[model samples]
Target: MTVTDTHTHLYSDAFDDDRKVMIERAIAANVTRFFIPAIDSSYTKAMLQLEADFPNHVHLMTGLHPTSVKENYMEELRHVEELLSKRKFVAIGEIGIDLYWDKNTLEIQQEAFSHQIRLAKQYRLPIVNHCREAFDEIFVVLETEKSDDLFGIFHCFTGDIEQAKRAISFNMKLGIGGVVTFKNGGIDKFLNQIDLEHVVLETDSPYLAPVPYRGKRNESAYIIKVLEKLSELYGLSQEVIAAITTENSKAIFKV
Candidate 1:
């Protein structure tokens, strides 16, 4: 059973002490594919280095994270443009409105999100979105930008059935992670309702680790706990869930 983590920050600082060990642990558990989301230009080198180290496992994405947007955002967007022009990445990602961090920059966040979506369309790559506490805002953008040319995963998705349908309408697969195991994650109530093919597995490592490891640092290996939860939710075996979600990941990332 080959499992895929559609969103993981294997290059994050939290893994500095034992990144290799953590990765090997995940690999041993059959977590074979790793999609790394880009935050900004500063981490580009680290991302590239990670891919060089694990060329077969690590697939890179390029985009400016919404929370990373600020006054110098145009410069950052330029950097994104330059990078896209130069090399290839699996997707344009982790990009969307993050009103939770700073509502003040909402306008710029929207601008950056739209810009990257256009970039993704231009490059004919899928997008990995990072919507947080801004569903309406994201929907507004998607409503206007919806097109056959636009499609991707809504990374770390946490929303209702209606919202899930809305995202799918815009050509997005819901990225399920640790949150689904949470008591109040909400998606659990309606997840089984959505087709498994519309969902993708992710750990968002160094972030939303599944329960049993909740409130603690998350590693890619911990994704098994999430796989178990999903197995239960979908009435499928862990191996089946792994295969289905990994197939879903391949459909979106094309990798």
Candidate 2:
């Protein structure tokens, strides 16, 4: 029963103290795969070091996160493009619109998101989207960039069934995470309507910890809580959820 943590930030400063222990704990819990998303040029070195540290277990993606989009967004995008030209990354991702934090940068966020999506298609790499409070904005860009080569996971997806369907139509898999385990998370309300095939498990470490660890810093090891919730909601065994979702992840990352 191997589980995949499709979204996690091993490079996060939150893990500065005991990152190795956190990963070891996840390994012991049978959550072997760790997909790391890039936030911006700032974290590139740390992210690369993480991949080097856990060559077999960690997969990396490069992009400018929406929240990181600032006035100098183009320079950041250039850094991302430079990385894409040099190294091999599983996807071009953790990219999308984020209106929750600041609405002022909405335009720049959209530009960066759309530009990254185009880069993903150009490189023939899957994307890892990070959208928050900006589904409408995201959909608009996705609608324009909709193409066979443009497909990836909607990382940390917490939208409704309609949004889930819309994401899939644009060639994205719904990334289910700790929120699915929360009693009032709301995503569980409509998750069953979507097939497990379109679903992929994640932890989004240092954020959105599952039930037992809610309100605390999340970690990849806590993906078990998510698996448990999926088991209960779908009436399937944890082993089954792990198997199917891990397979779906493999299909996306091609790892």
Candidate 3:
């Protein structure tokens, strides 16, 4: 059973001590595909090095993360555009308005989000969005940009049935991760109501670790916990969940 972790920060310093061993552990557990998201230009080198080292396993996305939107955001967006012009990427992603960290930057964040969405449309690539405490704001931008070309994964989706359906209307697949395993993670209550085709699996590692590793650092191999939870929720076997989610991922990433 091949598993795809649609979102993970393999280049994160969290894995610095045992990057190779940690990735190998995930591979041994059948989590072979790792889609890496960009935060800003600073991590670009590290992300590229990760791809160079794990050429077959790693796929990369290019964009300016919402939280990283600051005074030099225009410069950062330029970097994103330059990268897009130079090489191929799976998507323009992990981009959206994040009001949680700093509400003051909402305007800039929305501007960045809209700009990146246009970039994704121009490149004919999918988008991998990162929305946090700004569903209304994110939806507003998505509403303005809605088109046959506007399609991607709502990375780390945690919303109500109405929000989930709204995201689907924009052609986004819900990126289900460790949150589903949490007892209070409300999405689990209504997730099965959504078709499996509209969902994809992720770890968002080295963060949002599943149940057993809740308070601890997360790794790709721990995605199994997420898979098991999804199997239980969807009334399917782990293998089948893995197959369907991986196929859903392929449909989005085109990889």
- How high is the CA lDDT of each candidate model? 0.92, 0.93, 0.96
150-245 in candidate 1: lDDT tens per residue?
Answer: 999998988889999999989899999999999988999989999998999999999987898899999988889989998998899999999999
Clashes of each: 0, 0, 0
Task: Summarize candidate 2's per-residue lDDT along 176-245 as a digit string, tens digits.
Answer: 9999988888999989878999999999999999988899999999999999989988899999999999
TM-scores of all predicted structures? 0.99, 0.98, 0.99
Tens-digit per-residue lDDT, 161-216, candidate 3: 99999999999999999999999999999999999999999999989999989989
Q: Name the 10 consecutive residues with the lowest summed lDDT in model 3.
A: 92-101
Cα RMSD of all models vs. native, in order, equals 0.7, 0.8, 0.5
Worst 10 residues of 2 by lDDT: 181-190
The runs of at least 3 residues in candidate 2 whose Cα sits more than 4 Å from the true structure, single-residue gaps closed, are none
The better candidate by TM-score, 1 or 3, is: 3
lDDT score, candidate 2: 0.93
Arrange candidates by TM-score, descending: 3, 1, 2
- Candidate number that wins on lDDT, 2 or 3: 3
